[model samples]
Target: MDKKINIYKDVEALSEGFTSLLKEELSKREIVNVSLSGGSTPKALFNYWVANCKESIDWNRIAFFWGDERCVRPTDEMSNFGMTKSLLFDKIPTIDKKKIHRIHGENESKEEVQWYTSIMDKYLPKENGLPVFDIMMLGMGDDGHTVSIFPHQIDLWNAEADCVTAQHPETGMERISLTGRLVNNSRNIVFLVTGKNKAEKVKQIIEEREKFADIYPAAKVNPVNGKLFWMLDEGAASLL
Candidate 1:
């Protein structure tokens, strides 16, 4: 059974709720490992954490991981790890570099994928022979996709692997993403969605979770042993 599912009206409200939840998890577990997603909403929340909730995080005891990443150099501005560093790591003295497990997009993509998957397999909780992430943060695109799994990409949706590299149909850029199996095995999954453009799909996801499961990639997010929480602003929740 899931724990708690919630939605917020604004970023502040969402951040407040997330912060408290994170602290509670940290209090129970000495070492908290989290899988973070990229994009505008998360970038904003990362900045907010650095500026406001830095003290609330037990940085040294927390390990960072990415749910997905654009295949780009770490020094590239588009790198998810880079964004997190600029927004939070550099601002806080509580966390150590070694604690952050980044997806090496600049290296051989296949090798990097295998390496990271092994790391998760070795560290995360296991059930039915699959790694179970403690927490995973996700975002939805205007097209109703989440993480790097775009529409019409049947391989990504049904992948049984832990991780894989995929080509974005439109952008033609490569992406490294956790497979649905891994995502669905998490203990907690949070969707931080914003923007008016996402309202339609957000409504579709929340209302027709099973009906649209095939077309809307966002609807496929089913953490086997986790709670799925959606945090959205007014614009994103308008249709919901």
Candidate 2:
């Protein structure tokens, strides 16, 4: 795996760096397809974009997708898509409604997975029979989980489908997530991780890979034909 680690002094700096990176990517491509993750970590990035770059970027050419979402109504605070809409999408009026491809988290888990999979197949660019997202912004949990692929349910990482239904290890709440197969096909994969609580797991997954590969679900994210970047705040990179 060709992995690159970038550590920022704080969350604000990390958010700015990510925003700049996204802006650069969007400028380079006429149409950029990005899959976003939901977490406390990305909330700052969303806000930063709204405040600084919202008007400068060409919103119409950028299509939004999600990496995973909890099975909840769009109005629910727990909904990933809801958080994103409130923070980012709602602020960008120029973004076309058709470009915002959200998972119907209220639908049945398996049925939602199938619905999302078909959407991906129809819209995403395919390379080697797999959808290749232009950019995939992901966040890692303290448990070394990425997206909805928790450590206890690591088997879901290798699922053959582009998307699958996942159950949270502790809560058993249903989630629809993009499989590792689809994530690995991305053109660029960025892990935006923050907080001191995630320090050890981040160190284990990035530095001590061989030791934690079997246990850390985040370690399984190795882009076959794209660059993998770890954008961390000082708190998250302390153990590294």
Candidate 3:
């Protein structure tokens, strides 16, 4: 994996930098397939995009997908699709509806997993017999998990299926997540992380790799034949 670390002053600066990267990337191709992450920081990014770049961006040229989504109705507050829909999609009414491919959280976990897997296989470009997204965005939990692969269920990272059914460690809520193999196959994988609470795990993943391996799922995000980027704020990069 070719990796780069970008530390910003705060979430505000991080969002701005991410917006620039997104624009530069979208300009590189006619249709860019980007997998999204759900979280407060991403919420910030959406708001920034809406407030600053909505009119400037060529929304139709991008296809949107999610990295993971909780098993809940699209209207549910816990739903990743719901949050993204409200924050981004709702504001961009002209965006082509056919380009928005979401994992239906309302369906059964196993069923939705198969549904999303087929969607990826149909839409994403393939290389080495695996789906290859143009860009994959991920978030890191304080517990060092990325996507829905919690530390306790780390083996799911290598599940043969490109997408799998996952359960939250404590809540036990069902979720659909792209397995590590799928995420690692992307052309560009970026981790957008912030907050002081994540400093320890960030330190462990970046500086104490030998001791941290096999423990944190976030530490396992290595892009095969691709580039990896860490877009962090000062708080998350403090320990580094």
Candidate 4:
């Protein structure tokens, strides 16, 4: 469960650094498959990647996926697909629409989960029956939750299911998330957290937590046979 943590001062710097790393990874892999998390920080990074890395990427070789999303229409403001489209897809002309796979959380949570599972099963590298993603970009909430796995719901951490449709306790909306095992199977995992509010949880996950639990979903992020990196803004890294 060895992992590497990276700290930054702000979202802007994090975005720049991440975009640069993404471009480099793309150059090396030729085909880059990544699962992205939803949040303001990632939205900002999407915009930055669109503007800075669009031409550098081999658009057709990149596949886009989300780590989790609210069960809302693609047009909804809370929709992760909508945010990525608005901030990135619409701006990047080289990318083929087919390469950007958006989970239909709006229409079918279970169906989408199964469909995405099939997609991952078809595309990702497999070891011991699990698809190992190339890179999974995640975000941590102020409460220490990453993806839709919230505190008090550690059951999600141990979920043997590849994906699950759950409800956000506060929002009461449905969500589809890849199980911890699937995420930890990735070749690389990077968490992008911003704002001062997240500093405490970042510190707790990096310093205080041992095993991944519902109370600290981010603590569960350990890339299988790879590295886990955290890209944090100053406010989020303040406590670290």
What do the candidate models score in CA lDDT, each in turn? 0.83, 0.90, 0.90, 0.80
Which residue runs does candidate 1 get wrong by more than 4 Å?
1-5
Score candidate 2 by lDDT: 0.90
Instruction: Summarize candidate 3's per-residue lDDT along 107-223 as a digit string, tens digits.
Output: 988888888999999998898799999889999999999998999999999899999888999999888899999889988898999999999999889777657769998898888
Worst ten-residue run, lDDT, model 3?
204-213
| Model 3, runs deviating above 4 Å | none
Over 1-240, each residue of candidate 4 has an lDDT whose tens digit, in order, gives 657666766677788888766777787876788898888888888777876777776777888888888898999999998988988888888887887877887767878888978888887778767987678888887777787887767588669888888778787889988888888888778888888887778888888677544368777776667678888877788877
TM-scores of the models, in the order given: 0.95, 0.97, 0.97, 0.93
Which residue ranges in model 4 land beyond 4 Å of their true spot?
211-214
- For model 2, state the Cα shift of residue 38 in Å: 0.7
Question: How many collisions between residues are there in candidate 1?
Answer: 0
Clash count for each candidate, listed in order shown: 0, 0, 0, 4
Question: Which of 1 and 4 is the better model by lDDT?
Answer: 1
